[model samples]
Target: MTLTIFSFISFTGQKSKFSDIIKSKMYFKTKLKKIPLSLVKQENTFFYFTDENPYYFNLLKSSIAKLGILNPIMVQPFEKKYYRVISGFRRLQIAKELGFTFIPARILRENLSPSEILTAVLLSHPHPLSLTEKVRIVRIMKDLGISTSQICTRFGSFLEIQSPHLLEKYIRLSNYTPSVLSYISTHGLSLNQALAFENLSSEEQNLLISLGTCLSLKGYDFCNILKVLKEIETKEEKNVAAILKETEILNVSKDVKLTRSQKIDKIKKILKMKRYP
Candidate 1:
């Protein structure tokens, strides 16, 4: 019911610098109101910030179902009659699923720039974000014409990224297949390990994903496997998929008798032998 101009300056400490950047670039008024679900567009405009994990979705749904929406979803006016979601995408989805005709929303004017909308969305979440979320954010910002330097300088501290090179890694990750990205997110794959697959063909990536899943690979083992594969690829001048197929790594991956450790050990041995021999 109350309309107020959001202030970025209110956020202090490390966020104060980030707030200053947003404050200098954009300003928009937001109104707290109950908007009809029909008037709100279901499509996500700032989906980079959204958490796609089913477990988290169910948890959020349960919380909303029990307590109702304690916080208003943020939206921006769209197509004269409808509103696009800037943040709280999960909340909006859950609200619609629960058959709520009207949900509480903080509506921004249609004139807000993409950067402004994105900043508001980013500010909506005060807590730390997941690696996948940070990756997507950098990607989206880059896509919006923000330079990598600006992204690192403005968001690096807030995102807890230490350097521009690390931020660039996140940018590169945006180009990976959804399956690879999802695997990296769920498996806790290091940035280095994930980027190692960047040069691989789609088929090669798929093979590695299958191998990783079969072997239950993570951390150092995964990195070492990639290293060995690259070495073999370089010496033999063969693609990873071809190397894997030739060495029967796929079959080894599927073998029921071999334990995970045994499979990994055998696979590594095969790779080393192929590279050396």
Candidate 2:
């Protein structure tokens, strides 16, 4: 198999600018070598805290088949015989499935700590990493005893997280129950929605999940309905299952003529009346 390698070129007047760019954390030595795919192990910190999305796997496969991997997978020596994958897990998986015996890989420098390796992987990823993947990175950083403030200072702006508390919120998601995580993943729940759902009792959550499945609510509608159910449960001292069956909330949700926004508004209004009356 032919190995693809990356290198930096110096332009006449752009030399200084390129040098400065290389000095930034975002720039790394891109040179790569082709190594036996079987020698590389998927032992990166990212594998621990999140599940892979099969949809993304297929997308990656198609991209690789057409365009080939634009970036080299990062790896480091491990156990003196094997290399550990630091980033590009999905790409590696797809490459193997495509019957590639050897893969392009960049070997990370020696003596880096786990946190540093994790940081390098995060900064070097070619594709935009998912929020859940990032959360798992932060959780690992936390496990390595990095302070929340330090993490924010280093990655907050890049990850678009505004505050240390907000970063903490993402990290906490790693500790949510498996069923809840599965629900969040399968339904494509946003971070805000997951955070809201995380606060409910397991029973309340299961009922809400059932309600979503039953009504065939999609995307934001499912989240909004859950939020409404949560509000009514809090104020009216009722369970979600009871509210769905005993009240007209589910009926509002299933109404064919109402737009999704209208349904959300109606559900909120009905919940308010239940709380007040």
**Runs in model 2 lying further than 4 Å from the true structure:** 1-30, 46-51, 171-174, 178-190, 206-219, 235-238, 241-277
Best by lDDT: 1
| Per-residue C-alpha lDDT of model 1 across residues 1-277, encoded as one tens digit per residue | 0111223222222544554433333433444678899887656665455446788789889999999898888777767788877777778889989988988877766776677777666766656787777887877887888777766555655676647778778888888877888778767887777787788899999998898888878857878888888888888898889988999988998999999888888888898889888
Give per-model CA RMSD. 4.7, 7.7
TM-score of 2: 0.67
Cα-lDDT of candidate 1:
0.74
**If scored against the real structure, what TM-score would every candidate get?**
0.81, 0.67
Candidate 1, pairs of clashing residues? none
Question: lDDT of each structure?
Answer: 0.74, 0.65
Give the per-residue Cα lDDT of candidate 2 at 174: 66
lDDT of 2: 0.65
